[model samples]
Target: MTAGILAIDFGGTRTRVGWYSNVLELITREESLSHTEEPINAVIDRIIQLAQKVVPDCEVPSAIGICAPGPQAYTGYIRYAHTLPTWDNIPLAQRISAAFSNAPTFMENDANLAALAEYQFGAAQGADPALYLTVSTGIGGGAIIGGQLFTGWRGLAIEPGHIKFPAKDGKIYSLEALASGTGIGRLAWEKLAASNTPSSLRQIDTVDGKAVGEAAMQGDALALEVITEAGRWLGLGLVAMVHLFNPQVIVIGGSVVNLGELIFAPARQTLAELLIDPLFNHENLLKVAALGDDVCLTGAAIHAQKMLAS
Candidate 1:
Protein backbone atom coordinates (compact mmCIF):
# COMPACT_ATOMS: atom_id res chain seq x y z
CA MET A 1 0.00 0.00 0.00
CA THR A 2 2.99 2.32 0.44
CA ALA A 3 3.93 4.43 -2.58
CA GLY A 4 7.54 4.53 -3.68
CA ILE A 5 7.41 6.77 -6.72
CA LEU A 6 5.01 9.20 -8.33
CA ALA A 7 5.90 10.07 -11.91
CA ILE A 8 4.45 12.35 -14.56
CA ASP A 9 4.99 12.31 -18.29
CA PHE A 10 4.00 15.86 -19.27
CA GLY A 11 4.05 15.84 -23.02
CA GLY A 12 2.62 18.34 -25.47
CA THR A 13 -0.15 16.05 -26.63
CA ARG A 14 -0.84 14.01 -23.52
CA THR A 15 -0.16 14.06 -19.82
CA ARG A 16 0.19 10.92 -17.71
CA VAL A 17 0.62 10.24 -14.02
CA GLY A 18 1.93 6.96 -12.69
CA TRP A 19 2.23 5.44 -9.26
CA TYR A 20 4.79 2.76 -8.53
CA SER A 21 5.66 0.57 -5.63
CA ASN A 22 9.19 0.54 -4.20
CA VAL A 23 10.00 -2.32 -6.56
CA LEU A 24 9.23 -0.05 -9.53
CA GLU A 25 6.16 -2.00 -10.63
CA LEU A 26 3.48 0.24 -12.08
CA ILE A 27 0.67 0.19 -9.56
CA THR A 28 -1.75 2.38 -11.46
CA ARG A 29 -1.85 5.27 -13.92
CA GLU A 30 -4.10 8.05 -15.21
CA GLU A 31 -3.84 10.05 -18.40
CA SER A 32 -5.58 12.77 -20.37
CA LEU A 33 -5.03 14.90 -23.44
CA SER A 34 -2.78 17.84 -22.71
CA HIS A 35 -4.14 21.32 -23.36
CA THR A 36 -1.24 23.71 -23.19
CA GLU A 37 -3.43 26.77 -23.18
CA GLU A 38 -4.02 26.07 -19.51
CA PRO A 39 -1.56 27.75 -17.21
CA ILE A 40 1.19 25.88 -15.38
CA ASN A 41 -0.76 26.14 -12.13
CA ALA A 42 -3.75 24.49 -13.74
CA VAL A 43 -1.54 21.64 -14.95
CA ILE A 44 -0.24 21.24 -11.42
CA ASP A 45 -3.78 21.17 -10.05
CA ARG A 46 -4.70 18.43 -12.47
CA ILE A 47 -1.61 16.40 -11.61
CA ILE A 48 -2.37 16.64 -7.92
CA GLN A 49 -5.94 15.62 -8.57
CA LEU A 50 -4.80 12.66 -10.61
CA ALA A 51 -2.12 11.80 -8.07
CA GLN A 52 -4.62 11.75 -5.22
CA LYS A 53 -6.55 8.97 -6.90
CA VAL A 54 -3.79 6.35 -6.75
CA VAL A 55 -2.25 8.00 -3.71
CA PRO A 56 -4.61 8.68 -0.85
CA ASP A 57 -4.39 11.94 1.07
CA CYS A 58 -2.75 10.16 4.01
CA GLU A 59 0.02 8.42 2.07
CA VAL A 60 3.16 10.13 0.84
CA PRO A 61 5.34 9.06 -2.03
CA SER A 62 9.03 8.61 -1.37
CA ALA A 63 10.03 10.55 -4.45
CA ILE A 64 8.54 12.33 -7.45
CA GLY A 65 9.70 12.69 -11.04
CA ILE A 66 8.44 14.53 -14.09
CA CYS A 67 9.35 14.21 -17.76
CA ALA A 68 8.63 17.19 -19.99
CA PRO A 69 9.10 18.21 -23.56
CA GLY A 70 11.76 20.41 -25.27
CA PRO A 71 15.16 21.45 -23.95
CA GLN A 72 15.29 20.81 -20.18
CA ALA A 73 17.28 22.63 -17.57
CA TYR A 74 19.03 20.64 -14.83
CA THR A 75 18.49 23.47 -12.40
CA GLY A 76 14.79 22.55 -12.25
CA TYR A 77 13.75 25.33 -14.60
CA ILE A 78 11.53 24.96 -17.62
CA ARG A 79 13.41 26.67 -20.46
CA TYR A 80 10.70 26.42 -23.10
CA ALA A 81 8.15 24.02 -24.54
CA HIS A 82 7.50 24.34 -28.25
CA THR A 83 3.98 23.14 -27.62
CA LEU A 84 3.48 24.78 -24.23
CA PRO A 85 4.60 28.36 -24.63
CA THR A 86 3.44 29.22 -21.11
CA TRP A 87 6.12 26.98 -19.60
CA ASP A 88 9.05 29.29 -20.18
CA ASN A 89 11.22 29.72 -17.07
CA ILE A 90 8.80 27.80 -14.88
CA PRO A 91 10.12 25.95 -11.85
CA LEU A 92 8.26 22.75 -12.63
CA ALA A 93 10.24 20.35 -10.47
CA GLN A 94 10.14 22.67 -7.49
CA ARG A 95 6.39 23.16 -7.77
CA ILE A 96 5.83 19.41 -7.87
CA SER A 97 8.11 18.94 -4.91
CA ALA A 98 6.13 21.49 -2.92
CA ALA A 99 2.90 19.53 -3.48
CA PHE A 100 3.98 16.39 -1.65
CA SER A 101 5.02 15.74 1.91
CA ASN A 102 8.72 15.00 2.44
CA ALA A 103 9.14 13.83 -1.13
CA PRO A 104 11.89 15.03 -3.43
CA THR A 105 10.87 15.81 -7.00
CA PHE A 106 13.00 15.56 -10.12
CA MET A 107 12.31 16.62 -13.68
CA GLU A 108 14.15 16.24 -16.99
CA ASN A 109 13.50 16.29 -20.69
CA ASP A 110 11.10 13.48 -21.59
CA ALA A 111 13.43 12.23 -24.30
CA ASN A 112 16.36 12.10 -21.90
CA LEU A 113 14.30 10.29 -19.30
CA ALA A 114 13.14 7.86 -21.97
CA ALA A 115 16.75 7.10 -22.78
CA LEU A 116 17.35 6.43 -19.11
CA ALA A 117 14.39 4.07 -18.98
CA GLU A 118 15.71 2.11 -21.95
CA TYR A 119 19.14 1.91 -20.41
CA GLN A 120 17.83 0.73 -17.05
CA PHE A 121 15.08 -1.66 -18.09
CA GLY A 122 14.32 -1.55 -21.79
CA ALA A 123 15.98 -2.24 -25.14
CA ALA A 124 19.28 -0.46 -24.44
CA GLN A 125 19.94 -2.14 -21.08
CA GLY A 126 23.35 -3.55 -21.84
CA ALA A 127 24.71 -0.93 -24.16
CA ASP A 128 27.35 1.41 -22.79
CA PRO A 129 26.51 4.16 -25.26
CA ALA A 130 22.91 4.20 -26.40
CA LEU A 131 20.60 6.77 -28.01
CA TYR A 132 16.84 7.33 -27.75
CA LEU A 133 14.71 9.34 -30.15
CA THR A 134 11.03 10.03 -29.61
CA VAL A 135 9.18 11.04 -32.77
CA SER A 136 5.86 12.62 -32.00
CA THR A 137 4.53 16.16 -32.52
CA GLY A 138 8.22 17.02 -32.57
CA ILE A 139 11.40 14.98 -32.46
CA GLY A 140 13.46 14.96 -29.28
CA GLY A 141 16.31 12.70 -28.17
CA GLY A 142 18.58 11.73 -25.29
CA ALA A 143 21.85 9.90 -24.92
CA ILE A 144 23.08 7.22 -22.56
CA ILE A 145 26.85 7.12 -22.38
CA GLY A 146 29.09 4.72 -20.51
CA GLY A 147 26.00 3.21 -18.87
CA GLN A 148 24.90 6.60 -17.55
CA LEU A 149 22.57 9.33 -18.72
CA PHE A 150 24.72 11.83 -20.60
CA THR A 151 23.44 15.30 -19.77
CA GLY A 152 25.82 17.85 -21.25
CA TRP A 153 27.49 20.61 -19.30
CA ARG A 154 24.16 22.41 -18.82
CA GLY A 155 22.05 19.27 -19.05
CA LEU A 156 20.94 20.30 -22.51
CA ALA A 157 23.42 18.33 -24.55
CA ILE A 158 21.09 16.47 -26.88
CA GLU A 159 18.89 18.41 -29.27
CA PRO A 160 18.93 16.14 -32.29
CA GLY A 161 15.57 17.23 -33.60
CA HIS A 162 16.54 20.89 -33.54
CA ILE A 163 19.61 20.31 -35.66
CA LYS A 164 19.05 22.12 -38.96
CA PHE A 165 20.06 21.01 -42.39
CA PRO A 166 20.03 22.69 -45.79
CA ALA A 167 17.77 20.72 -48.05
CA LYS A 168 17.49 20.24 -51.80
CA ASP A 169 14.47 22.55 -51.72
CA GLY A 170 16.93 25.34 -50.94
CA LYS A 171 15.46 25.65 -47.47
CA ILE A 172 16.82 24.80 -44.07
CA TYR A 173 14.64 22.91 -41.65
CA SER A 174 15.12 21.21 -38.33
CA LEU A 175 14.95 17.42 -38.35
CA GLU A 176 11.69 17.63 -36.42
CA ALA A 177 10.25 19.99 -38.98
CA LEU A 178 10.99 17.49 -41.75
CA ALA A 179 10.66 14.06 -40.12
CA SER A 180 8.48 14.03 -37.00
CA GLY A 181 4.81 13.15 -37.08
CA THR A 182 3.87 16.77 -37.59
CA GLY A 183 6.52 16.97 -40.25
CA ILE A 184 5.24 13.86 -41.97
CA GLY A 185 1.74 15.30 -42.00
CA ARG A 186 2.96 18.56 -43.48
CA LEU A 187 4.91 16.64 -46.10
CA ALA A 188 1.81 14.66 -46.98
CA TRP A 189 -0.10 17.87 -47.52
CA GLU A 190 2.64 19.24 -49.76
CA LYS A 191 2.74 16.08 -51.84
CA LEU A 192 -1.01 16.03 -52.20
CA ALA A 193 -1.15 19.63 -53.32
CA ALA A 194 2.03 19.86 -55.38
CA SER A 195 1.43 16.63 -57.27
CA ASN A 196 -1.71 15.05 -58.56
CA THR A 197 -0.85 11.70 -57.05
CA PRO A 198 -3.74 9.30 -57.30
CA SER A 199 -3.86 8.13 -53.72
CA SER A 200 -6.18 7.49 -50.76
CA LEU A 201 -4.43 10.12 -48.65
CA ARG A 202 -6.24 12.77 -50.63
CA GLN A 203 -9.48 11.36 -49.30
CA ILE A 204 -8.60 12.16 -45.71
CA ASP A 205 -9.81 15.60 -44.74
CA THR A 206 -6.97 16.38 -42.35
CA VAL A 207 -3.97 14.38 -43.37
CA ASP A 208 -1.87 14.15 -40.26
CA GLY A 209 0.73 11.52 -39.53
CA LYS A 210 -1.83 9.15 -38.08
CA ALA A 211 -4.07 9.46 -41.11
CA VAL A 212 -1.15 9.06 -43.49
CA GLY A 213 0.10 6.09 -41.54
CA GLU A 214 -3.31 4.46 -41.73
CA ALA A 215 -3.39 5.07 -45.45
CA ALA A 216 0.06 3.57 -45.80
CA MET A 217 -1.10 0.56 -43.80
CA GLN A 218 -3.79 0.10 -46.40
CA GLY A 219 -1.06 0.16 -49.09
CA ASP A 220 -1.76 3.57 -50.54
CA ALA A 221 1.03 4.48 -52.95
CA LEU A 222 1.24 8.18 -52.16
CA ALA A 223 1.07 7.52 -48.45
CA LEU A 224 3.89 5.06 -48.83
CA GLU A 225 5.95 7.68 -50.65
CA VAL A 226 5.32 10.24 -47.98
CA ILE A 227 6.23 7.88 -45.18
CA THR A 228 9.30 6.69 -47.06
CA GLU A 229 10.60 10.21 -47.51
CA ALA A 230 10.10 10.95 -43.84
CA GLY A 231 11.92 7.77 -42.98
CA ARG A 232 14.83 8.79 -45.21
CA TRP A 233 15.12 12.12 -43.47
CA LEU A 234 14.94 10.28 -40.18
CA GLY A 235 17.75 7.99 -41.28
CA LEU A 236 19.92 10.87 -42.37
CA GLY A 237 19.34 12.43 -38.99
CA LEU A 238 20.21 9.15 -37.32
CA VAL A 239 23.42 8.99 -39.33
CA ALA A 240 24.31 12.41 -37.99
CA MET A 241 23.49 11.29 -34.46
CA VAL A 242 25.62 8.16 -34.77
CA HIS A 243 28.62 10.14 -36.00
CA LEU A 244 28.23 12.69 -33.25
CA PHE A 245 27.46 10.42 -30.30
CA ASN A 246 28.96 7.19 -31.59
CA PRO A 247 26.10 5.41 -29.87
CA GLN A 248 26.38 1.64 -29.85
CA VAL A 249 22.61 1.35 -30.17
CA ILE A 250 19.71 3.62 -31.06
CA VAL A 251 16.22 3.10 -29.60
CA ILE A 252 13.33 4.94 -31.24
CA GLY A 253 9.86 5.34 -29.76
CA GLY A 254 6.71 7.52 -29.64
CA SER A 255 3.44 7.80 -31.56
CA VAL A 256 5.23 7.29 -34.85
CA VAL A 257 6.26 3.84 -33.72
CA ASN A 258 2.64 2.95 -34.43
CA LEU A 259 3.49 3.29 -38.11
CA GLY A 260 5.43 0.03 -37.69
CA GLU A 261 7.65 -1.16 -40.54
CA LEU A 262 6.10 1.30 -42.91
CA ILE A 263 8.39 3.92 -41.43
CA PHE A 264 11.30 1.92 -39.99
CA ALA A 265 11.98 -0.20 -43.08
CA PRO A 266 12.98 2.82 -45.10
CA ALA A 267 15.02 4.28 -42.25
CA ARG A 268 16.85 1.00 -41.79
CA GLN A 269 17.45 0.71 -45.50
CA THR A 270 18.78 4.25 -45.59
CA LEU A 271 21.13 3.51 -42.73
CA ALA A 272 22.32 0.40 -44.50
CA GLU A 273 23.00 2.34 -47.68
CA LEU A 274 24.44 5.54 -46.28
CA LEU A 275 25.76 5.23 -42.75
CA ILE A 276 29.52 5.65 -42.72
CA ASP A 277 30.17 3.31 -39.80
CA PRO A 278 29.43 -0.20 -40.88
CA LEU A 279 29.65 -1.57 -37.33
CA PHE A 280 26.48 0.34 -36.43
CA ASN A 281 24.91 -0.28 -39.82
CA HIS A 282 23.45 -3.60 -38.75
CA GLU A 283 19.72 -3.88 -38.04
CA ASN A 284 20.21 -4.92 -34.44
CA LEU A 285 22.18 -1.77 -33.78
CA LEU A 286 18.95 0.22 -33.81
CA LYS A 287 16.06 -1.00 -31.67
CA VAL A 288 12.43 -0.16 -31.17
CA ALA A 289 11.84 1.26 -27.73
CA ALA A 290 10.31 -1.24 -25.30
CA LEU A 291 8.13 0.82 -22.96
CA GLY A 292 5.64 2.27 -25.39
CA ASP A 293 3.53 5.11 -23.88
CA ASP A 294 4.95 4.40 -20.45
CA VAL A 295 8.55 4.98 -21.51
CA CYS A 296 8.79 8.49 -20.11
CA LEU A 297 6.82 7.70 -16.96
CA THR A 298 9.09 4.77 -16.17
CA GLY A 299 12.09 6.96 -16.82
CA ALA A 300 10.69 9.55 -14.43
CA ALA A 301 10.41 6.92 -11.74
CA ILE A 302 14.00 5.89 -12.36
CA HIS A 303 15.06 9.50 -12.07
CA ALA A 304 13.23 9.82 -8.76
CA GLN A 305 14.83 6.64 -7.46
CA LYS A 306 18.28 7.86 -8.46
CA MET A 307 17.72 11.23 -6.85
CA LEU A 308 16.37 9.68 -3.68
CA ALA A 309 19.38 7.41 -3.48
CA SER A 310 21.72 10.28 -4.05
Candidate 2:
Protein backbone atom coordinates (compact mmCIF):
# COMPACT_ATOMS: atom_id res chain seq x y z
CA MET A 1 0.00 0.00 0.00
CA THR A 2 1.18 3.50 -0.75
CA ALA A 3 2.09 5.82 2.09
CA GLY A 4 -0.70 7.90 3.57
CA ILE A 5 -0.71 11.46 4.92
CA LEU A 6 -2.99 13.27 7.31
CA ALA A 7 -3.82 16.95 6.84
CA ILE A 8 -5.36 19.11 9.52
CA ASP A 9 -6.66 22.67 9.26
CA PHE A 10 -7.16 23.84 12.80
CA GLY A 11 -9.05 27.09 13.12
CA GLY A 12 -10.33 29.11 16.04
CA THR A 13 -13.82 27.66 15.83
CA ARG A 14 -13.47 24.48 13.82
CA THR A 15 -11.03 21.82 12.73
CA ARG A 16 -10.98 19.88 9.47
CA VAL A 17 -9.06 16.67 8.81
CA GLY A 18 -8.28 14.84 5.58
CA TRP A 19 -6.58 11.53 4.86
CA TYR A 20 -4.75 10.94 1.60
CA SER A 21 -2.83 8.07 0.05
CA ASN A 22 -1.57 7.33 -3.45
CA VAL A 23 -3.17 3.89 -3.46
CA LEU A 24 -6.63 5.30 -2.74
CA GLU A 25 -6.21 8.31 -5.02
CA LEU A 26 -8.97 10.01 -3.08
CA ILE A 27 -9.10 12.04 0.10
CA THR A 28 -11.37 11.15 3.00
CA ARG A 29 -12.31 14.21 5.05
CA GLU A 30 -14.16 15.13 8.22
CA GLU A 31 -14.99 18.36 10.06
CA SER A 32 -16.00 19.35 13.55
CA LEU A 33 -16.92 22.64 15.25
CA SER A 34 -17.27 21.11 18.69
CA HIS A 35 -13.55 21.44 19.25
CA THR A 36 -13.95 25.03 20.40
CA GLU A 37 -15.37 23.88 23.72
CA GLU A 38 -12.77 21.19 24.28
CA PRO A 39 -9.31 21.49 25.77
CA ILE A 40 -6.21 21.30 23.58
CA ASN A 41 -5.48 17.68 24.52
CA ALA A 42 -9.05 16.67 23.86
CA VAL A 43 -9.04 18.42 20.52
CA ILE A 44 -5.80 16.72 19.46
CA ASP A 45 -7.07 13.34 20.58
CA ARG A 46 -10.28 13.80 18.68
CA ILE A 47 -8.38 14.75 15.53
CA ILE A 48 -6.16 11.67 15.86
CA GLN A 49 -9.21 9.47 16.37
CA LEU A 50 -10.83 10.94 13.31
CA ALA A 51 -7.70 10.46 11.23
CA GLN A 52 -7.45 6.79 12.26
CA LYS A 53 -11.06 6.22 11.34
CA VAL A 54 -10.59 7.69 7.89
CA VAL A 55 -7.31 5.94 7.08
CA PRO A 56 -7.63 2.44 5.58
CA ASP A 57 -6.81 -0.33 8.04
CA CYS A 58 -3.15 -1.46 8.10
CA GLU A 59 -1.96 1.84 6.71
CA VAL A 60 -0.28 4.44 8.89
CA PRO A 61 0.23 7.96 7.62
CA SER A 62 3.86 8.78 7.00
CA ALA A 63 3.42 12.34 8.15
CA ILE A 64 0.88 14.89 9.24
CA GLY A 65 0.58 18.53 8.19
CA ILE A 66 -1.14 21.16 10.28
CA CYS A 67 -2.28 24.64 9.26
CA ALA A 68 -2.78 26.69 12.37
CA PRO A 69 -3.11 30.30 13.50
CA GLY A 70 0.14 32.21 13.81
CA PRO A 71 2.73 33.59 16.24
CA GLN A 72 4.20 30.17 16.87
CA ALA A 73 7.58 29.88 18.63
CA TYR A 74 10.69 28.50 16.94
CA THR A 75 10.04 25.10 18.48
CA GLY A 76 6.58 24.93 16.87
CA TYR A 77 4.67 25.84 20.00
CA ILE A 78 2.11 28.61 19.75
CA ARG A 79 3.27 31.52 21.93
CA TYR A 80 -0.13 33.08 22.14
CA ALA A 81 -3.47 32.68 20.48
CA HIS A 82 -5.71 35.66 19.83
CA THR A 83 -8.57 33.47 18.67
CA LEU A 84 -8.19 30.06 20.27
CA PRO A 85 -6.97 31.03 23.73
CA THR A 86 -6.80 27.48 25.04
CA TRP A 87 -4.03 26.62 22.59
CA ASP A 88 -1.65 29.24 23.92
CA ASN A 89 1.96 28.13 24.40
CA ILE A 90 1.04 24.56 23.50
CA PRO A 91 3.70 22.32 21.92
CA LEU A 92 1.27 21.42 19.21
CA ALA A 93 3.74 19.99 16.72
CA GLN A 94 5.57 17.93 19.31
CA ARG A 95 2.36 16.53 20.79
CA ILE A 96 0.78 15.81 17.46
CA SER A 97 4.02 14.30 16.18
CA ALA A 98 4.35 12.09 19.21
CA ALA A 99 0.80 10.84 18.90
CA PHE A 100 1.46 9.26 15.50
CA SER A 101 4.28 6.76 16.19
CA ASN A 102 6.81 9.63 16.11
CA ALA A 103 6.08 10.35 12.51
CA PRO A 104 7.28 13.67 11.18
CA THR A 105 4.75 16.48 11.25
CA PHE A 106 4.94 19.92 9.70
CA MET A 107 3.05 23.06 10.72
CA GLU A 108 2.56 26.44 9.10
CA ASN A 109 0.42 29.50 9.52
CA ASP A 110 -3.03 29.03 8.02
CA ALA A 111 -2.80 32.09 5.80
CA ASN A 112 0.58 30.98 4.50
CA LEU A 113 -0.84 27.57 3.71
CA ALA A 114 -3.79 29.22 2.01
CA ALA A 115 -1.41 31.15 -0.20
CA LEU A 116 0.49 27.98 -1.01
CA ALA A 117 -2.78 26.32 -1.95
CA GLU A 118 -3.67 29.20 -4.25
CA TYR A 119 -0.22 29.21 -5.81
CA GLN A 120 -0.30 25.46 -6.34
CA PHE A 121 -3.95 24.90 -7.32
CA GLY A 122 -6.15 27.99 -7.03
CA ALA A 123 -6.30 31.62 -8.15
CA ALA A 124 -2.55 32.29 -8.07
CA GLN A 125 -1.72 29.29 -10.22
CA GLY A 126 0.99 30.11 -12.78
CA ALA A 127 1.67 33.44 -11.11
CA ASP A 128 5.28 33.68 -10.02
CA PRO A 129 4.71 36.37 -7.38
CA ALA A 130 1.36 36.42 -5.67
CA LEU A 131 -0.35 37.61 -2.51
CA TYR A 132 -3.17 35.79 -0.74
CA LEU A 133 -5.16 37.92 1.67
CA THR A 134 -8.05 36.58 3.73
CA VAL A 135 -10.37 39.26 5.15
CA SER A 136 -12.33 37.31 7.71
CA THR A 137 -13.23 37.95 11.36
CA GLY A 138 -9.68 39.27 11.35
CA ILE A 139 -7.43 39.74 8.35
CA GLY A 140 -4.39 37.57 7.57
CA GLY A 141 -2.12 37.44 4.56
CA GLY A 142 0.75 35.52 2.94
CA ALA A 143 3.02 35.95 -0.04
CA ILE A 144 4.47 33.73 -2.75
CA ILE A 145 7.68 35.00 -4.29
CA GLY A 146 9.29 33.08 -7.13
CA GLY A 147 6.43 30.64 -6.70
CA GLN A 148 7.54 29.66 -3.18
CA LEU A 149 6.15 30.57 0.22
CA PHE A 150 7.96 33.78 1.34
CA THR A 151 8.10 33.24 5.04
CA GLY A 152 10.02 36.19 6.51
CA TRP A 153 13.15 36.52 8.63
CA ARG A 154 11.50 35.00 11.69
CA GLY A 155 8.75 33.17 9.83
CA LEU A 156 6.22 35.88 10.84
CA ALA A 157 6.14 37.90 7.69
CA ILE A 158 3.42 39.32 5.48
CA GLU A 159 1.00 40.11 8.27
CA PRO A 160 -0.75 42.81 6.27
CA GLY A 161 -3.59 42.99 8.77
CA HIS A 162 -1.21 44.21 11.45
CA ILE A 163 0.29 46.91 9.31
CA LYS A 164 -0.73 50.30 10.58
CA PHE A 165 -2.66 52.57 8.24
CA PRO A 166 -4.84 55.61 8.61
CA ALA A 167 -8.60 55.17 8.75
CA LYS A 168 -11.03 57.78 7.45
CA ASP A 169 -11.05 59.55 10.78
CA GLY A 170 -7.30 60.17 10.49
CA LYS A 171 -6.56 57.71 13.26
CA ILE A 172 -3.94 55.08 12.54
CA TYR A 173 -5.16 51.52 12.83
CA SER A 174 -3.98 48.14 11.72
CA LEU A 175 -5.42 46.97 8.43
CA GLU A 176 -7.35 44.28 10.28
CA ALA A 177 -8.65 46.73 12.87
CA LEU A 178 -10.03 48.84 10.05
CA ALA A 179 -11.19 46.40 7.38
CA SER A 180 -11.80 42.95 8.79
CA GLY A 181 -15.31 41.54 9.25
CA THR A 182 -15.19 42.50 12.90
CA GLY A 183 -13.83 45.89 11.94
CA ILE A 184 -16.67 46.47 9.51
CA GLY A 185 -19.22 45.60 12.16
CA ARG A 186 -17.53 47.89 14.65
CA LEU A 187 -17.62 50.67 12.10
CA ALA A 188 -21.31 50.10 11.50
CA TRP A 189 -22.13 50.14 15.19
CA GLU A 190 -20.04 53.21 15.83
CA LYS A 191 -21.53 55.03 12.90
CA LEU A 192 -25.05 54.23 14.04
CA ALA A 193 -24.31 55.29 17.57
CA ALA A 194 -22.34 58.44 16.80
CA SER A 195 -24.87 59.77 14.33
CA ASN A 196 -28.64 59.55 14.26
CA THR A 197 -28.41 57.95 10.81
CA PRO A 198 -31.16 55.38 10.80
CA SER A 199 -30.27 51.95 9.44
CA SER A 200 -31.96 48.59 9.11
CA LEU A 201 -28.92 47.22 10.93
CA ARG A 202 -30.15 48.92 14.11
CA GLN A 203 -33.04 46.47 14.19
CA ILE A 204 -30.64 43.55 14.66
CA ASP A 205 -29.93 42.73 18.28
CA THR A 206 -26.22 42.37 17.61
CA VAL A 207 -24.26 44.44 15.14
CA ASP A 208 -21.77 41.82 14.13
CA GLY A 209 -19.98 41.72 10.79
CA LYS A 210 -22.36 39.25 9.14
CA ALA A 211 -25.33 41.36 10.17
CA VAL A 212 -23.69 44.41 8.66
CA GLY A 213 -22.99 42.54 5.43
CA GLU A 214 -26.55 41.28 5.37
CA ALA A 215 -27.85 44.78 5.91
CA ALA A 216 -25.71 46.06 3.09
CA MET A 217 -26.99 43.30 0.84
CA GLN A 218 -30.52 44.43 1.64
CA GLY A 219 -29.74 47.89 0.26
CA ASP A 220 -29.33 49.64 3.56
CA ALA A 221 -27.51 52.87 2.80
CA LEU A 222 -25.65 53.04 6.11
CA ALA A 223 -24.44 49.46 5.89
CA LEU A 224 -23.29 50.00 2.33
CA GLU A 225 -21.39 53.08 3.42
CA VAL A 226 -19.60 51.12 6.14
CA ILE A 227 -18.61 48.39 3.70
CA THR A 228 -17.36 50.93 1.21
CA GLU A 229 -15.25 52.62 3.84
CA ALA A 230 -13.81 49.30 4.92
CA GLY A 231 -13.03 48.64 1.27
CA ARG A 232 -11.04 51.82 1.16
CA TRP A 233 -8.88 50.67 4.04
CA LEU A 234 -8.46 47.31 2.38
CA GLY A 235 -7.50 49.07 -0.80
CA LEU A 236 -4.94 51.19 1.00
CA GLY A 237 -3.38 48.08 2.49
CA LEU A 238 -3.33 46.40 -0.93
CA VAL A 239 -1.74 49.45 -2.46
CA ALA A 240 1.14 49.21 -0.01
CA MET A 241 1.52 45.51 -0.70
CA VAL A 242 1.48 46.08 -4.43
CA HIS A 243 4.12 48.76 -4.22
CA LEU A 244 6.31 46.58 -2.00
CA PHE A 245 5.99 43.21 -3.73
CA ASN A 246 4.75 44.08 -7.22
CA PRO A 247 2.86 40.82 -7.10
CA GLN A 248 1.38 39.58 -10.34
CA VAL A 249 -1.83 38.56 -8.63
CA ILE A 250 -3.65 39.12 -5.35
CA VAL A 251 -6.00 36.31 -4.33
CA ILE A 252 -8.71 37.41 -1.92
CA GLY A 253 -10.80 35.00 0.18
CA GLY A 254 -12.61 34.56 3.51
CA SER A 255 -16.17 35.06 4.73
CA VAL A 256 -16.26 38.79 4.01
CA VAL A 257 -15.60 38.29 0.30
CA ASN A 258 -19.17 36.97 0.11
CA LEU A 259 -20.14 40.64 -0.05
CA GLY A 260 -18.87 40.35 -3.59
CA GLU A 261 -18.92 43.57 -5.60
CA LEU A 262 -20.11 45.58 -2.66
CA ILE A 263 -16.57 45.34 -1.32
CA PHE A 264 -14.53 44.53 -4.40
CA ALA A 265 -16.00 47.24 -6.54
CA PRO A 266 -14.99 50.03 -4.19
CA ALA A 267 -11.69 48.35 -3.41
CA ARG A 268 -10.87 48.13 -7.10
CA GLN A 269 -11.77 51.74 -7.59
CA THR A 270 -9.63 52.83 -4.65
CA LEU A 271 -6.75 50.65 -5.78
CA ALA A 272 -6.85 52.17 -9.22
CA GLU A 273 -6.87 55.68 -7.84
CA LEU A 274 -4.05 55.14 -5.33
CA LEU A 275 -1.65 53.25 -7.58
CA ILE A 276 0.85 55.84 -8.85
CA ASP A 277 3.28 53.43 -10.51
CA PRO A 278 2.18 51.97 -13.82
CA LEU A 279 4.26 48.84 -13.27
CA PHE A 280 1.77 47.38 -10.78
CA ASN A 281 -1.50 47.80 -12.67
CA HIS A 282 -1.59 44.55 -14.55
CA GLU A 283 -4.91 43.36 -15.88
CA ASN A 284 -6.73 40.77 -13.80
CA LEU A 285 -4.27 41.21 -11.00
CA LEU A 286 -6.94 40.74 -8.36
CA LYS A 287 -8.89 37.49 -8.24
CA VAL A 288 -10.92 35.56 -5.72
CA ALA A 289 -9.51 32.29 -4.40
CA ALA A 290 -10.92 29.38 -6.40
CA LEU A 291 -10.16 26.61 -3.92
CA GLY A 292 -12.52 28.00 -1.27
CA ASP A 293 -12.47 26.28 2.13
CA ASP A 294 -10.48 23.28 0.93
CA VAL A 295 -7.45 25.40 0.03
CA CYS A 296 -5.74 25.02 3.40
CA LEU A 297 -6.49 21.32 3.62
CA THR A 298 -5.06 20.72 0.17
CA GLY A 299 -1.96 22.73 1.05
CA ALA A 300 -1.47 20.78 4.25
CA ALA A 301 -1.70 17.49 2.38
CA ILE A 302 0.87 18.66 -0.14
CA HIS A 303 3.19 19.88 2.61
CA ALA A 304 2.85 16.60 4.46
CA GLN A 305 3.65 14.67 1.31
CA LYS A 306 6.77 16.76 0.78
CA MET A 307 7.91 16.32 4.38
CA LEU A 308 7.48 12.57 4.21
CA ALA A 309 9.33 12.43 0.92
CA SER A 310 12.24 14.46 2.24
What lDDT would each prediction earn against the true structure?
Answer: 0.84, 0.83
CA lDDT of 146 in candidate 2? 78
Alpha-carbon lDDT of model 2:
0.83
Candidate 1 — which residues are off by over 4 angstroms? Answer: 1-3
Indicate which candidate wins on lDDT: 1
Residue 297 C-alpha lDDT in model 2: 83
Question: Model 1 clash pairs?
Answer: none
lDDT score of residue 301 within candidate 2: 80
lDDT of candidate 1 over 62-94, digit per residue (tens): 888888876764567777778777777888778
Which RMSD values do the candidates have, in order? 1.8, 1.8
